[model samples]
Target: MKSKQENITIISIVIVRRFICFFGIAIIFVLNGYAQINELSIELEIVSISKGNYHPSPQELIKGDTFPKRIDFEFIVYNNSNKMLMIGSNTRCYYHSDGKETNYEEIGRFLMINGTDTIPLYTDRYYLHPNPHSSVKAIWGIIDSSKDFKACPIFTPFLKRWTNVGKDNTKELYNYLKSSRFVYVPILADYQRVLDKLNNKSIIDCIIYPRNTLEVKKKEPFSVFVGYLEEKDYDYIYPSEYK
Candidate 1:
């Protein structure tokens, strides 16, 4: 038999090894749980055009010079998971223009019309619970005419429409606008700890914005409308002409 002192030392070594193994296993479980908790699944579908108009402001219409074309779209968000997901009040969605680095913000205050009542998109925690889904309508684009050098002047007449063939007339422009994808960032209740990890990263160089990795499966196809000014006659014109 081993000496009493030697046996004590061996027992202590065994306890330490078991403790380390338990600790490692625990860590792995924790990380795996984190990954699952952070995961989100949802769907987004562009339903229809809510409004299409060209006018920076009502007061500026007298000048006959419209710089920005505004177009609004109706969209639906469907919850694909069995569990309820929470979207914060300040949640924002961005449109990626033809996979370019430039991103455009979805206009604030998307209203949900529920027959007699109208609800704002943002809530303390927009609980997307199970199957049903939510509908929201808001302005999607405010494209500036100045961005395209070849763009026709806002007040250009219909007879001189041939001169207006530029960036707006290209199939690439239409495809670019149509192919634009939206990235939505919403806070999830189970994955709140992910934000802490983001905070630990280098804040000075990185813009840390958290977005859910919910695959947006489209149930319906959507169309885009281009807004411009059209002159009906030499003396009369339509301020908001959508095509």
Candidate 2:
């Protein structure tokens, strides 16, 4: 019933609407891809012995016994995307040496700073909320957590007195320091795996939801102090200097 000119105009309107919708969808896809590629940036650096306070002094040296010291590994995570990221407390540190890989699961206690409050990452359910352009530091170490003095009540006094005498070669601390080469430490956001799997699911009621993917910003590894070995000196530096 419409005129030829009116029909042509209607068709043109439909075509323009379709083109606009298609263009908007394409822009969303591009932005989403960019966000996925660079959601979070991670940088790792070795805190020096002096800065980390892990080296011991001469007064704490014991004769003929191996002293235990912790080597600190620091992780700086930055949220590069606009969306808020949820980093799980299940963070892990990997040490690569001589084609062999050793994993150190969250050792001692690590903290996450969100705004003014410092949240401790000790429990299994803890989550870090790093907003856009915000950064958080997660500190881990090669300290032995298996030997709980409280668990061994009978040997508590003896263990406390002879802390520097016993060395567990099978533990993580021994293997971490034994490597002569530069330790390749990678701090991974293990929670990202959960986020990847929940791409299509509704995470509103979920206790732990995924955010942006954590990316490594720096290509090179950051160096840190391992240990000092003096010539003919059997005593090595302990992480904590005993007065």
TM-score of candidate 1 versus the correct structure, residues matched by position: 0.33
Model 1: clashing residue pairs?
A: none
For candidate 2, lDDT tens digit of each residue in 113-220? 323433232223334443334445443432222222233222223223223433423233322323322211223444444444555555523322223333333224
Model 1, residue 48: distance off in Å is 6.1
Cα TM-score per model: 0.33, 0.33
**After aligning candidate 1 to the native by TM-score, how far in Å is the CA of 76 from where it should be?**
2.2
Off by over 4 Å in 2: 1-37, 47-68, 91-127, 130-143, 147-221, 226-243
Error of 1 at 239 (Å): 23
Error of 2 at 121 (Å): 12
**Over the stretch 1-243, how does candidate 1's per-residue lDDT look in tens digits?**
899999999999999999999999999887755553344333334322211133434554433232222223333343333433333232122221244533322212333332343323322223322222332212232222322223333212211221221222323333433454433434444334433444444431232122433323333343343334342222211112322
**Which of the numbered candidates is closest to the native, going by highest lDDT?**
2
C-alpha local distance difference test of each model: 0.35, 0.38
